[model samples]
Target chain A: MSVENFLILGLGWAGIFLPTALGAIGSIVGCARAGQAACGALLDVESGYGRLVGASALPSSQTIYGIVVTMQLNRQVSVEASPGLFALGVLVGLALLCSAVLQGSCVASAINASKSKPEVFGLAIAPAAIVEGFAVFAFIFGLIISGGIPGTLAG
Target chain B: MPTATNYYMLVASLPRMPRTFEVEQVPISRLRLQQRLEMLNEEDTTTVQQMQEFLLWDRQHPDRTDTEVLQEYEQLMQRVRNVLARKIIVYRMDVRTITCGLRRRRLGMDPPSGVGQWVQAIRENWEHPDFRLARQHPWIPLVRGYMEAHQPLQTERQLLLAIWNQWTRLADRYYFSFETILLYLARWEIVDRWTRLNESLGRQHFESLLTEALGEHARFPQ
Candidate 1:
């Protein structure tokens, strides 16, 4: 392949992987922090394993959303599809990244609060769920728009 | 450590027993001392004699009010607060433990939101009208006596009423759930009275109370 073809192919690959990679990174970091909070909470309280584990995993859904978007955007890589792919991939990934990390922080706080006052567990998770809603919107729109990208007929 | 001035300010804040009242000839006990202090609030003449007797019974310091007695009483009240707080913590733990066990058995996974739904149910229903009435009645003495007696897990009606009132108020203002409120009452053996009935029968009793308290058509619905 010519150098020009190689560059376009690389860009295409970047578009495919960027959002999933960034989202996974966000999920890992966010869940890790929440998991740490869960551990601390367990040391002080005798029960509530479900809330701790659930809160810690809340950010992981972003990664799945990213994967779905990535799959929806999957198609033959060519210069024609690069811009649309890049725009959707980078923007959706960024949204997932920010939302996951922030949701993780919210979950961590909820876990800590619930540890001391288990009665607040349900109310405390409301913020994280709200954050997850934003991620879902991005994922759905990304899916809707990715289908419209035009592929080149050139061989 | 507090400076001497600060210590003096703190001590000055609490009401001092009057010097004019003569100490009574009767024996002084902690319970009698508490009763005498309460009697002071009633404007009752009988309480004055008990307070004077309890205040000056000290042999080494007959004339001086053993401010130490008052200080000790304050400490006792603080201890009661501590015990109540611990009981709340343990009750929350119980909810989490139960939710966790159920989740593990049912889903083979950790609980997602702990006992959040259960907590929410308690928080929402705790303020039923019956609970409010319970709070109006003072039951601290009953609670303290039960704790002192080290009785079994049986509940007392007055104590239960008092706790339902206590926790319902907390639920109204704070994010705490019904368990925290109930456990605080239970720690003092208050809920045991309500629970003494069969579980379904107890449910019916509370359901009726909640319906009446909330004035709602279907609050705490079965």
Candidate 2:
């Protein structure tokens, strides 16, 4: 095979893996941000450390969704699959990345609010959940689009 | 050296301050606030601390002059980078300028324009109630009214409330950022100062009333 075909197939693999890779990147940033707030909140409050840490972990779901979506996108790498793979991978990755980062910010806000006013704890998490819902939308649609891509099923 | 300010942690550690000076005392003490701000690098902490020291009412030593304060304001404006933070410093100076203008005008010290345009405008428009800058600072008329009534305490409270509200708006616009931390410190200082003033004033009021009551009792017909 020519170098052209090899390069094209390589691009296809890159695309197939982008979602998981990008999602993990987003999760790393998101969790770090939320975790910092959690640690800060711990300094001011006596209890509820468990929930703050749990909320910080909320951004990790993007990685889980990414992993599942990656599995669905798994197919025989080809030039034909490359375009579809790259588009799907880059878009989903971007969505997950932004959502996770923003979700982390929302979680941090919730933690900050709750630390001062514990009564608002349950209500504040709603913003982070809404952000997570957007990420889920990206994941669900990515999974659906993966099957429609013109490629032979890996048996 | 601290690599970053860890603004998120710093901001999160601070309590939510009200938009106005409604709190009787600061939610966090100055010492504790300083401790949390220890996260900032030494250089930044020095700058921030220096800036916070400016515009304090009682900070003026007998020898301190207006030129010194104005010079410090310019120096701080150069050192600080954030636009909102810079605006905060300017707002402080504006408050000081307007108050000074009001007092100087009342004292009948009308002179030629020597300072910034705003001061010059205050001088030039001595005849005008708001100095033609009423739109920029709507509270000017209200402050003028208090001054006219010779209610210095009310004027002080109004000025403090205005500053508190400005800091509150800046804090609300930005969160988990460096400027937000600065704004928090500003509000905390206001709260701290308000508490101190209230305490002193309260003591003075109680002492005066007690003395008056005792004097009246002693003078009563026997």
Candidate 3:
């Protein structure tokens, strides 16, 4: 293949994979932050260890959503399609990234709050769940946007 | 991605501390706090250690002279990397200086014209109660009241609690950052100091009071 064609294909591949890459990166950071708090909460209280750990894992949902969006974006990935792929994939990935990391902070705060006031545990997690909802919005929209690109399942 | 230096785990592991003087006992035991402190990165751990050293009730260096201690503290301000730490130290200096001025005035001594940071503040506002600082620090008036009343315990509690409250505000501002951990340690030291006061020093105060009362009663003077 020509150099231009190779470059286009490479760009397309990057676009196709950006969502997963960025999402995973964000999830890794987010999970680690929340997990650290969970581990800390475990030190403070014994019985709620399971719940804290569960809450910490909430950020990981963004990564799953990113995967689904990327699967939907899978297609011929031609020069014509690469720009759209890059735009949607990167935008969705960034949204997922921010949502996951921000949710991690929220989860950490939740853990800290609930460790002291156990009654607020359920209420504390509501914010984190809301953050995940934003990521899902990006994921579903990314899938819808992917349908416009040529040779994709929707196309 | 990995929160290597962030204090989320350490802060979370520690129990929520109540207001200063609210509890006689610290929420976390020394051993447990030490274990949690081990999680701090080398640099922040050093900062915490250095700052804690300055938290001793009288803030005196037993081995070092006053000049040397001031020099050491000046060096600490330069060496500590955190802005919050520097700001806290400056705030502490102002508080300590005001307290010193209060004590010197209580003793009818002129503000010493020597190697101190706040001699100027004291000398300039020598005649003014609260040393013109009452507006900035409303507690200045209260601290002055306690000092003049010869209520050292109350004076100390007020001073320490003020410091504790300052640290609390600083911690709340930085919430999840490493600065929060630093402020947490500072506040913890205040709680520890309050609780520790009820032991040896408290007994000494009580004994002294009893002796003074007996001495007053045994006034068989010509």
State residue A20's C-alpha deviation in candidate 2, in Å: 0.9
Instruction: List candidate 2 segments past 4 Å from native.
Output: A152-155, B111-117, B213-222
lDDT of 2 by residue, B1-222 (tens): 457777777777777776566567888887888789898876568667756766464456657577775676677767776666667777887777787788778888864332344887876788887889889887888898999999988898888888887777667788788777778878877888788888889888987887788976634476
State the lDDT of candidate 3 residue by residue for B2-23, as single tens digits: 3367578888888988865547
Better of 2 and 3 by TM-score: 2
TM-score of 1: 0.41
Interface RMSD of each: 17.2, 0.9, 1.0
TM-score of the A chain in candidate 2: the value is: 0.95
Indicate the residue-level lDDT of A3 in model 1: 93
Worst 10 residues of 2 chain A by lDDT: A146-155
lDDT of model 1 at residue A30? 82
Which should have the higher DockQ, number 1 or number 2?
2
Per-candidate clashes come to 7, 0, 0
lDDT of 2 at B200: 86
